[model samples]
Target: MDTIASLFSFITWPVSWVIVQFHKLYGAIFGPDTGWAWGLSIVSLVVLIRICLIPLFVKQIKATRNMQALQPKMKAIQERYKSDKQRQSEEMMKLYKETGTNPLSSCLPILAQSPFFFALYHVLSKIASGDKIGALNQQLVDSAREAHIFGAPIAAKFMDTPEKVEALNASLTDVRIVTAVMIVLMSASQFFTQRQLMMKNVDLTVKTPYMQQQKMLMYIFPVIFAVMGINFPVGVLVYWLTTNVWTMGQQMYVINQNPTPGSKAQDAYLQRLLKSVTQHGEVRGRGRKRVVKDIVAKGSDRNENERRFFAGLAKAGFAAQADGTVVKSDTVSAEAEGGAGTRRQQPKRQTKAQRQAAAAQQAKEAEDATLSVEATPEDKPAPSLEKGPKPQAKGAKPGAQDAADKPARPSRANSGGARQGKSGQRKGPQRPKHPSSKK
Candidate 1:
């Protein structure tokens, strides 16, 4: 550990300078020899480093999302070349090159912080050993060595020997308790950060090795932190805890504000936009407008969540415009609310066999009806077959039985010629012969 920290000794001066500057400010409120002063100085140093690494952090986010997006393709490549490890690696590199993605970019913030972290660890070790290093003079070193955070010396570690802890004027138990608590918080924060990312920000619809790797890392990272945390000085633990907290809050902000498309966070974000648009009848913020514009641009290609957002807007009497503005649209709202364009209940399309069967059924019904009329008994009859009235029977009315049994046909116009058939065929008047043949 000493050798590893010494390898980053070049950064020790800068790290020490930043810590001393923070210590000065904190020392004013809390005595210079107190835990709050030195402890907060470590936290401030972490914040300062993280602030400078913001650009790297942003790059890391982009790389992570890009990696997620490329997972399926990567998996395909892997399957395609499983027997050829060299070729697979070549293809992977090609893919990375084409996409301009650096797999290592996801580790940028951590990689960038390592130097400072180790430098701080080295500086703290020197203080506990009663040695002066970097920007911390003997007086400052003495003060830092004497500072106790939660009854544990700031330079004392959980694994420090009892003799060494006693030399720092701290009980081993106190150091272990303080360091253990800090380690747990640090690990817990790390776990929560990754868990939230996996749970909310990632595209849950996709099942990929990328997601699997993330799930593995989510568990792996906390364990690594906890294991390594035993040897970390109290000051170093404070630095790590602060960095983890900063990372968590930073990630949360990004998830809330600019989550990946099709993610739960994005769904939540869209819901918030929908509510705001519903209340105000317009997109209020530029960020919101941008989100709406992207959704509008998706058109019918929108995911389930985006489509739901559009539906919500439509139901609320608003429609998103191409320019990202929401306008009052009674047409959309009415259609959404009233289901105005409800699908017509069209008759089911019959197959050829079904049509034939239907036609036969109708014919059979007509034949039965005709047979029923013809089979009626002759009793009580009033009309005869010669188109004359039947002999009066028992003084019955002459035409009583022949009274209209069916609807009458419509009368044809008098065209001064033989009348046309109800089928509409013309039967013109005949003259003699050729003019006569007609007669």
Candidate 2:
């Protein structure tokens, strides 16, 4: 353990150096006598570490995707070498090598920071026990020893000292309370951050042993941390809690903006995009290289409502064309016009009552037209069945007719004198023929 501690102290010199810088900066600002300075220095250390590890975080994401992509290959190898454990292991390693993937890359960030974590823990433990240790001289150690955050010593542990045991036996002391609260928070944050990745970001369709292990570790790590937290100094607990908070927030942002294609987070992102399109006539991706649009603007004739809506979309990083198409703000105008062409206008927004009322009005008009067609003869006009051929209505187009003005046919009984025979002879005025023969 001593040899390990020596190695960690050397390996994590940069981290310790950063911590000392923050400690001094905060101490100068808030007085070296206050615990807030020391406690917040630990927080600042976490922030610095996380900022430096961003590239590693991005690498971890790429590695996760690479691992997911290799699932099929891994499964095939497993099936091929099911009878031979050594062969399966060798083949899996070969596959990982070929794909430029590291199975352990997911844990790289934490593993890289482990030495720093332990180094800080050792430094604080020594400072709490009145021993001057690595990078921290006697004067800094004296200040650290005096640093009490919320009445709990910065380096105090739950079961560390005789006074702490007596305080536990007696009543609630600031040391126990602070330690317990920090441990709970740290454990909870770790658990939820891991849980969010598994539930929202993971592609459930690609179920593999690696992901299964992750799921198991999600629960396992929290329990382990909770059990182990009792032995960790309060300063170490603060560091871990701050780190967990940073990870959670970073993960949330990644999930919200650039989630895996088939994950629940992606679905949620799409839903948010659709809502934006509906409300503001456009949607834009946040901090994303590629932007997807669900709506377009057409024509410059926008009213106050549309102008306001589009202005919001523009502020959110959507660009509008002169022809009314909206695309990603980062896209060049030539590309936008080429790809995101003019789209059909969205249907006018209407309330449910308005639609219902319009439908009802149409139905009523149709019913009235049917009733008019079914009118009784008593309601008919006199000219509708007149003997004379009616002239077309003035200014009416050819073939146009009005029901009330249409000409009617002559009655058969009143046209007997002009009857024609089937032999093609017209019998005009048949009474004259009868007078010439024998009436």
Candidate 3:
């Protein structure tokens, strides 16, 4: 059993040795005696990783921008096959191919960072555990043991007993407090960094579902980190906090210097940054303070001009007031006068069928009227037996003739009048004129 245990330890020794080397590397670069050194190492790690992934970041930005630009075309394709699920899927794939934009581009930076993050975690954990001193060389192990910042040793166990604390090189209470503070700062800085990227750096026109997914992850990942932070060792917390601060600063620089135009947060961030830069120098010295005052004076003048322009527009009844209410003349001319309640009256509603029927009826009536107006008098039939009073038998009763004649009179008058006094009047025209004469 002892040999088996020794064998297992030997098998894991290389992994432990690598972690020790990483810790030593950090300690050497950032003085092993100070927490600030470790903090700086964390910052350095972040900077190095970010620099390495710069190409990936650029690709991601380009991909996102391309996706946004293709939104209109994609929407059109969606609309074209809204009811065809299979076709929509095929078309979407084709669109993606044509655009050469992958939805996964945004995650490339995170994917690249994951391995480095894991490595850092391992290094910090090993440093905090203080159990694998045999894996490290004598010089590294001695330096690590001497590593203290503000009287708190980096290798000190935060949950150590009172006796163990006294035995340790630094105050356990202070180490635990520092660890807790670092964890909180780590969580907070990560949240803010991610929040700014999501709210400020993203392009507004990207309607891809993946962009929304990325946004959700941006918020969710930070919250997850915050919740899991408590479990991390103080050394790990220090690294995480420093890394987060670097990320925040990096994001701030990117958003302020190269903001997406349609992003509200990006614009605001840029404006704020510009205001800061114009008024204050890189450092806030007394000279920069005076410069800021001058910038403020210029900003005030521009604001005054804008206010005056808006005021003029408002006075002319062409603009809304600051409260969003439009000002208009209240006086009504005779032509414009109406009942006060009339302005507020709701429009009458019509059902679809009713509206269609009304439209059809109107069209038919218009067509008939137009045909009548276009027809020449000669084209219309002259009054004949069809329209005139029927000829009565030689001894027909007057009552029968009167009843028959009454119905036919109006028709005869209309048709006869349509061809009155024409030189080429046909025999049919003469017959209708003689019928009324006979009566």
Query: Model-by-model lDDT, in order?
Result: 0.89, 0.75, 0.59
lDDT of 1 by residue, 1-439 (tens): 8999999999999989988999899999998899998888888888788899999989998998899889999999999999999999999999999999999999999898899889988998999888999999999999988999899998888987899999999899998988889999999999999999999999988899788888999999999999999988888888899999999999999999999888999999989988888778789988888888988898788898999998998899998899899889889988998774585677899999999999999999999999998885779787665665446569667576566533455444434254555555446652323643543
Off by over 4 Å in 2: 1-4, 164-172, 275-439
| Global CA lDDT computed for model 1 | 0.89
Over 4 Å off, model 1 = 345-439
Summarize candidate 3's per-residue lDDT along 1-439 as a digit string, tens digits. Answer: 2233243443344444554545566767766655655545455556666788888887776776677667778888889999998999899888889878887896688776665555545544445555443466555545555666566655554555656545556676787777667666776787787678777766654566646766787778767876766555555566567667766886787676555535655446434533443343232345433433443345434333234433333333332223323235433222234444467878699999999999999999999999999987877787665665568889878788777665554465456655556676653444444555756
**For model 2, how does the per-residue alpha-carbon lDDT over 1-439 read when each residue is reduced to its tens digit?**
3355566777455655676788888989999868888988889988877898898888889898889879888899989999999999999989988889987887789987788788888777677667776567788888888888777887778776666534323223677898999999999999999999999998776777878878999999999999989988888999999999999999999999878755788767656654666466543444321424212333354433344545555555566554434566644434445443566667899999999999999999999999999977877666665467568878987666664555565466535564564566556543335545854
Judged by whole-model lDDT over C-alpha atoms, candidate 3 comes out at: 0.59
> In model 1, what lDDT does residue 34 have?
93
Prediction 1 TM-score vs. true? 0.78
Candidate 3, residue 436: lDDT: 50
Candidate 1 positional error at 404, Å: 47
Task: Indicate the worst ten consecutive residues by lDDT in candidate 1.
Answer: 430-439
TM-score of each: 0.78, 0.62, 0.49
